[model samples]
Target: MVRKEKLDSMFNAFSIVSGGNYVYVCDMKQDLSRWSKSAVDYFGLPSEYMENAQSIWNEHLHPTDREYFNESINAIFAGSDNNHTLEYRARRLDGEYVVCVCQGVVIHDDDGKPEYFCGSIKNHDSVNYIDDVTNLRSLYGFLDDLKSAFWKKQELDILMIGVEEFSRTNDIFGYTFGNRALRKLGSLLLSEFRCEGQVYRMDGTKFAVIAQKSSIQRLSEIYADLQETCAKEFYVGSDRLTLSLCAGALHLERFSVSPDTVYSCLRFALHESKGNHHGELFEFQEVVIDESRNSLTRLNEIRNSIVDECVGFELYYQPVVDAKTEEMCGAEALIRWRNNDYGLVPPFLFVPILEQDSLFPELGKWILREAMICGNRIRAKYPNFVMNVNLSYAQLERTDFVDVVLDLLKATHFPAKNLCLELTERCRLLDVKLLQNIFVRLREEGVRIALDDFGTGFSSLGVLRKLPIDCVKIDRDYVLNIQSNKEDRNTVKFISQLAEAFNAELCVEGVETAEMRDMLRKFNVTSFQGFYYSRPVPIEEFCVKYSC
Candidate 1:
């Protein structure tokens, strides 16, 4: 009795000295009796709570945390552990909730039997690491903990989880419901992967986990588990939401990986996974990363070359021949790159990358101006010469696209009728109606529109039906095998018929053989272009050969 009173007095003095923070002493072996003046007031507990503090604490804890609280407390009392430090949400007096960190030390009697556990309570509402919405650590907190482990030279695997097509979810159901889905997913991940690692809520629809010292095989298993979990549908309000997850992982070994580099590499891998490896985990490879970095550096050089009007940027023209006469009736303008160090960089390698960037429109403008100027210079000698320039989605979607073409024609005194803009299938159009309107205006201005790579995309028929296109350029795949493959010949015949029905010309690309040309002739292909007649050549060489 005397010993108990002395401990109580010490706790009371300590609580007062600690600026009224909640402090408690519990006789774990004896009915779990406890005392704390601050906790009594903060939790709205009566004096009776002291008789059974374990029960009272358990009652106020968040339901999800109840088992953990019991396990940790029981472990200490059973002498399996000497101390316990845990954070959990606890309900307060006015029905509000706050996260509290409780740390306790187990005291032993003369015979080393467990006697009591004493602890202080710290309210962590202001500086809590836990995200309020997801109940996971915030990105900042996760990075901090990750850096700590990284500095200690521990082998680690970091996985970034992204909710696929998440933007469509927000667009369809509104952000409020989107947030609910995220919260549910966060809870699901936390509950499922607690043993494997700590999960963190990354910015918008991206979550991450730091699996400490996990092997590649274990990470692969975890990734498979996550895929299965996300495959199940979740209910939000009355709507059922289904999500597909893409994960990217980077293995970090001690001195080899820096925090910044790890994040950069992991994010890059995640983007690749989302775009190309759907439902799979992409592990970072040094060679792939090095290639990407080198490509980016080379692209930067290309961008600088374009901006500075460097000689590295030039257009090469490939002859488009009349299939029967083999006459060079027109040509398609193709962009090429040449650097002092890399010599002539392959257009197949760089053009597609540039076409997807913002600078593509600017590059398109340059191509249009140069091609028009060259076409005007040659029109007197060859009145039937046509200038075909390719257009990317970035260029065609710009509001000033038609105006830019018109301005270039006026500046170069080039006939709009001779200028053809080829729209490639790779372009993604958001506003088909807007494009149709632009096409109508351009057609009125005497500019022809050709649908390039016609048979490749899902929207090819839709484009023909809706847009004012003048020509259909059948993709090369059908033409390459038309001589041997009956299906290829039938497809070409069908496309030729379809084009004629629309009052459009059908030009077959990739006619590399005399047999291919003869085969296309049967389908009434209006024009043929490929290595058979000529490959893309410099503007100077093209003028010297085909000017007259």
Candidate 2:
């Protein structure tokens, strides 16, 4: 009776500690030593189950996991390790499989012979499962591991491709169709290559694949096949639609020295492919090294210039001449960088980089104030002269841009009519109401706004009709070949007529020769700017060259 009472207490204690009170003991020779009452209950076995314990356990294990489990157990018996832990799917009594984590430690007798092994199993269905981010099984976990271990490699090759202009599809069709199309693409990739490679849904409209030591021939074949597969039309909810993908391939081993280096190389390749008129695949080349290094160096310098004030920026002016008067009317303000080491980096090379960095908002404010002061000095000498300053898309998006202009105008006391704010067609593509309010306020204050690079982007017509623009400057590409190409002449004529319809003045840039000027004159383009008049000159030289 006392022994029975002690056994009850032990069972209750075990239940409280393990929450299951199930235990199984087996020898290294695959013989069962003991099984607790809770073990029989857990496996749903009869009291006579001890006789066939090995077979019962083996039969319950998932076929896919059985071989690995046996190998791990055998290794532990061979004294490979003292403790073993594994996760596998085990068949429950009801015939459904449950994921379980099992851990065991070996015990030895006084004679140094293996006595028995004890282990407990825990339900891992809730704990070990990974959250799904894509349809591909185990993809997120794989990516997490890769991101953690990727730093060990000096280089990596990455391929990123996705449907072009997916946003338009989402807008035209419903988002449900767009999501179905994306899922179909994901499933296709998973079924094709998940066993041999890793895939990631980088973001909306983008997918990436990573390959380690993939040979050039193999990579080419893979890319060609993917391109062909992605090109095929997909049926989403009975509508058949085809989409083209732009692919960028970067070979990390060749260019990457650090973790960030790989990302940079891949991004540069992606940028090149996107900028191509055709959706072509671009491969990493050595030239990208120099280009990337230059970009990084310039970005760092610009960032430093913003904070330190030790480095300063220079302003160059190019004269704008009146067609009929053949005299200087105004000059456009151009920004140049004069690094102590690099010495005079052109605006073309650095301006776009600055825009991408969104440094233009601060840089734009500085340029405005400086240009106002400079224009005030020029106006003191020549009252009717004007100064045009170019503004970037980022600067236009600022709610405070109008206030900044007003503050500068008040501080400098320059005539508002003589200050021209130049904006590209791209700027007008932003929020319409914000642009309208800003332009209306500026125009009401007597400040003139010109649409620079007039024929470049898609929104030119909308810009002229909507924004309160005072002038339209035709881009140089349309003006350069006007004398030799009929197509260019026709384009110039169309733009000039549009300017007339809008009642805005026209400025034709890039007039290098007399023939170009004559051709422009035929279109009634009055204001001209380019090397034909004078190359952009330093402030001192410009003052001497155009001072009246």
Q: What is the C-alpha RMSD of each candidate to the true structure, in Å?
A: 17.6, 15.2
Q: What are the lDDT figures for the candidates, one per model?
A: 0.77, 0.69
Q: Which regions in candidate 1 have their CA more than 4 angstroms from the true location?
A: 1-168, 179-227, 233-240, 245-296, 303-311, 397-400, 428-434
Q: What is the lDDT of residue 101 in candidate 1?
A: 71
Candidate 2 residue-wise lDDT at 185: 76
Worst 10 residues of 1 by lDDT: 286-295
Error of 2 at 180 (Å): 6.5
lDDT of 1 at 193: 68
lDDT (C-alpha) at residue 449 in model 1: 93
Task: Kindly list the per-residue Cα lDDT of model 2 for residues 1-548, writing each as its tens digit.
Answer: 54334434543444466656355556554454345675566556665225446556777888967876777777767777677766666777777776666777777767876655666677644432232435543333334334423424434556766577787777888787778777777776666555435666754576667766564355556766766766675666677777777767765443223223334445445555766535567775543325345454454565568555425687888989998786888889998878766678777765654563445678888888878788777777778888999988678877788998898899888779999998865464467777789889999999999889888863469768988988899889997777678999888888889989989999988888888887788886869999988999887888887663
